[model samples]
Target: MRAAALKWVLWDVKDTLLKVRFSVGEQYCREAERMGLSLNPVAVNSAFRQAYKSYSSRYPNYGIGQGLNGHSWWTAVVKDTFSLCGVQDSALLQTLSNSLYHNFCNAQNWEVFNDSKKVLEGCSSLGLKLGVVSNFDNRLETILKSCDLLSHFSFLITSEQAGVAKPSLLIFEQALQKCGVSAAQVAHVGDHYINDYLSSRTLGIHGFLLDRDNKYDRSEVVPKGHRLNSLEELPSRLQQPMD
Candidate 1:
């Protein structure tokens, strides 16, 4: 058997492998309208941004630091988002919030990228181990399962479980331990510049910045060689002498 350059590939979940099928606002609008709440999608989008920012600031990492669990934390954000859009009825708010929280847990709200599964298979066939190192909550397992991606990863690590989020080296360290590999033996990939790329790079793991949207096309922070527009580029990149 040919030896692999890297022993493992640690992946970032959201936006890297899979993502919510619709924009949060669009999904919220759909749910809200079904519940008889008239709302403008644009308004919901704007409100959602504010609500999410406020919640994440006050209670980062699904609010584990504040003694809050993922459900309560996300529900609080959902409530605030709708309230900002003038949802005053407590019963209706609870219903909408609960609905969204669970709805996002499965394939009902998520979709795997076209290149994700193929890339995963490619990596596996190369004798490299695969695992996830994401900042997601506990629902990550169920989401991946629902999307038929659970089997691709040998292990899964989330911020809620790790008690720390990305951009913090602690989570990556936990993943390295679980995979039984050193930083130099693994490569990490994600869409976020700081959380996914630099954080792993700082810890001595090779990093690939997945930029499907061209969001960082001109940014000096992302190296041209490391910026990937698709996972289709990954197999080839892995075969090269990675930095």
Candidate 2:
């Protein structure tokens, strides 16, 4: 069945609204340099990526589901990443891990997309309720606030707070509850094909895949109307009638 017209707009944080200055690998290399580790940036980054893939695949939620705090969960990832680089110094690993964690918590490490604020303001002006549904930790709220985008949202729900991540109906349900809207009345805009688009659509929420880079291959599975090149296109898209 066709979903109801969108009334609430839920956003995904990381790539949808904000983009990091460099890869997580680059961030780790910078931290290593500051700590006086004479490492090959490329090699270290490659090792870190491999380590990250292994850990994420193993724990999925990176132990966040197992009661690991955001800081501690990330510390383990950092340590493992550096360990693969042959850095076995316990004290140094801890220091580098802590640095990486705190570094990302800073707003300077991220850049808000140029169109993000304008799109947010436009949605707000259209009387659409806005919120965030992300697989992020609480640092999401802080990041948005620092970017001056926090006031636009009615609520920010994170995986840490919801006790689950996206693609799970539970997290999206929490946002629906907080916004006082039914799934049919909301549209989720995000970059990830599965996490943002399919997940929302499967639950009867309108899904708009924000393909800013135009990277996704079009398929019959993804309705043409659901793919957007920019949030700026959202207001216009919302005005269109749903079948």
Candidate 3:
């Protein structure tokens, strides 16, 4: 049977279209060395990655259960990451973590994915409504604009604006509302299996998983969705009708 054509393309920004560099990691490691604490860049990077995942997964629940704000949620994880790394100075770690705000705010600290602009242009030319559903702070618009991709999206919904993150139907729903499309008519593309694929699928939105790192095994049955290694592949995927 023929499938429905996709009318809207929803996206996840960080790690999907943008590569976020943790400037705080290098800054913190330098501070740790100055304080005579041993810190490995690889170890810190690994710990920070795990900490970010844990925070993203746990914070929404924390917001629901304990009424903790997102900033506090993230701060707690940053503190824990430093503590677990055996950094004894709480004040220094706090200072370094706070420094991350600078990196995130500065456009120079991030690089737009190699294929992001091309995919965006192709989708826009195809007349598909483009929107961003990202777990981000208020600086999301500025970041996108800095990369000259802000004009490509008709709707830009961020966690700070939506009061919820991806994997939460509210975020996707709000984006769809802005685009004036139903969940079933839109398709979301992102990197994470859970946040992008499972979450969107549960809401009846089609999912396209991007395996940028080639970490997922192709032989393993990809869940009922399209999978690609880069945004460069998105145009062709979009050319196909949605199921």
User: What lDDT score goes with residue 70 in model 3?
Assistant: 48
Poorest stretch of ten by lDDT in candidate 1: 217-226
Which residue pairs in candidate 3 collide?
A: none
- The TM-score of predicted model 2 comes to 0.93
TM-score of each: 0.94, 0.93, 0.78
Tell me the deviation in Å of residue 210 in model 1.
0.9
* lDDT (Cα) of model 1: 0.90
Give candidate 3's whole-model lDDT.
Answer: 0.76
Judging by TM-score, tell me the better candidate of 2 and 3. 2
Model 1 regions more than 4 Å off: 1-4, 217-224
- Error of model 1, residue 177, in angstroms: 0.3
Whole-model lDDT for model 2 versus the true structure?
Answer: 0.83
Pairs that clash in candidate 2: none
Provide the lDDT at 76 for model 2: 87
Model 2: per-residue lDDT, tens digit, 39-81? 7778877887787787677666646766676677778888988
- Candidate 3 residue-wise lDDT, 1-243, digit = tens: 555567899999988988755555665576567656678877877777778778767766335345665456666767777877876677877765665544466677788887999899999888888899988866788888877889998878888767877778888878877877667778889988888877888888888888988877665315433788878888877787676
Candidate 1: tens digits of C-alpha lDDT, residues 1-243 = 443358899999998998878888899999998997778889999999999999899999999988998899999999999999999899999999999999998797998999999999999999999999998889999999999999999999999999999999999999989888778889998999889989999988889999899887557444567788899998888888767
Q: What are the per-model numbers of colliding residue pairs?
A: 0, 0, 0
- lDDT of candidate 3 at residue 4, scale 0 to 100: 56
